[model samples]
Target: MAHLGESIDVDNIVPERGDFEALPAGPYMVQITDSDVAETKAGTGLILKLTMEVMDGPFANRKLWTNLNFRNPNATAQRIAQEQIKQICDAVGFQGQLTDSEVLHFRPMRVQLVVKRDEQYGDRNEVKKYSALNGSAPPANKPQPQPAAQKPASSAAQRPASGGQTRPWGNRAA
Candidate 1:
């Protein structure tokens, strides 16, 4: 069990809610702070849930989230997720197999966020793209051209690597 350390004084405390509104759609510098794997709704696949925190600007420290469908029954969905992960890896300069997700954390990357609206769920922010802060990353909307095949870089960063109260609202494919 968990304790609050002190007794509560509910009546004396001000009841103000922190802003739950989503941040405006734009590229924000952020880093993955946490990640975990969970079974998908249908139990047919798994999802890699990522928790990211904004690293700069007025909204510094604000959190954003995304889920990559690591495995899914739908081929399109899985492909999309793989592509998304590749984008992130490329941004962080990781060019080989990603056995662990922890290696992606703590590296500041610029992510293009979009405000998504749904009639049933109001508005939420979706991580549309990831790029390195060095500006070498391709535009999020454009497809990155393929280069000649090459061996994985040997010096790639190798690092060993949420429970969720609610399902994340972003990354829904039509």
Candidate 2:
């Protein structure tokens, strides 16, 4: 891939059809029709068009996905390999083989072909982080809720030196 400016690591990967436990329904292709990226940003991005039917396991599948950016886009095959593993596993789903790309038994499917992973590999924690900050409530161990909302001092309390319409507190106009 060519050089591109900084990119957001959505942390979601579109999996290949074969990865699903069941055959993809049909007419499946990952695509990125529209992007929020600015025109000034150089280089292009890969938007997948994964057909939902492709993964025909069961229930109406609804989930979110994302991918982290490569630490070093240029040079460094090891990093490339790591990101590829991250991509493949993330797309197809990996259990973090404890070797960072180790072939995953990936529960349910348990495909033999998988990448081993290191302890810190395939950060499943990214999702957790997203939820922690952006998601709803934080961990129970987290700090307690702070104070409640309070309105600014009512301007009605203070009439500037300049004369202004004034009304008695809680007074009703009959």
Candidate 3:
């Protein structure tokens, strides 16, 4: 049990309200405030989850989440994940490997958000594309074909190799 130090005035107190509506889908400047890698629930693949915070405009302070499955057996999924990660690295001028522990909050990047809907899960925001910030040239909408000898930054060895447990959002299919 705890005791109150002073008498509280319940009549004058008001509860703070929070907005639950999702931000309208569009291109927004965001900073990666947090990131982590985790295995899928079935223990078959790994996913990188990035928590991004909107840096400016009307949606400032809002949070957006994105997941990239870089270790999946499916080739197409792997390719898509690699492309997204590469776009991010290039946008922020990061070269070489990327790890879950690396600090990615220094610079903000532009990301186009789209709403994804599932019969059972309803609708949620998904990162449809990533681009360089203002004053920088935007990347091609589609990844240009690369030679087999020249590997992209998101190559298997350069991705997050391991983590302790599965992430809550990582279980969803890519």
Best by TM-score: 1
User: Candidate 1: what lDDT?
Assistant: 0.77
Error of 1 at 53 (Å): 0.7
lDDT of the candidates, in the order given: 0.77, 0.29, 0.71
Of 2 and 3, which scores higher on TM-score? 3
True-vs-predicted CA distance for residue 54, candidate 2, Å: 7.5
Angstrom error at residue 31, model 3 = 0.3
Distance from true location, Cα of 16 in model 2, Å = 28
lDDT of 3 by residue, 67-111 (tens): 898889888988999899888876764544455435355467898
Better of 1 and 2 by TM-score: 1
Segments in model 3 whose C-alpha atoms lie over 4 Å from true places? 1-20, 135-174
* Candidate 1 structure quality by residue, lDDT tens digits, 104-152: 7887889999999877867889988888898675433233443446433
lDDT of 3 at 167: 31
Question: Model 1: which residue pairs collide?
Answer: none
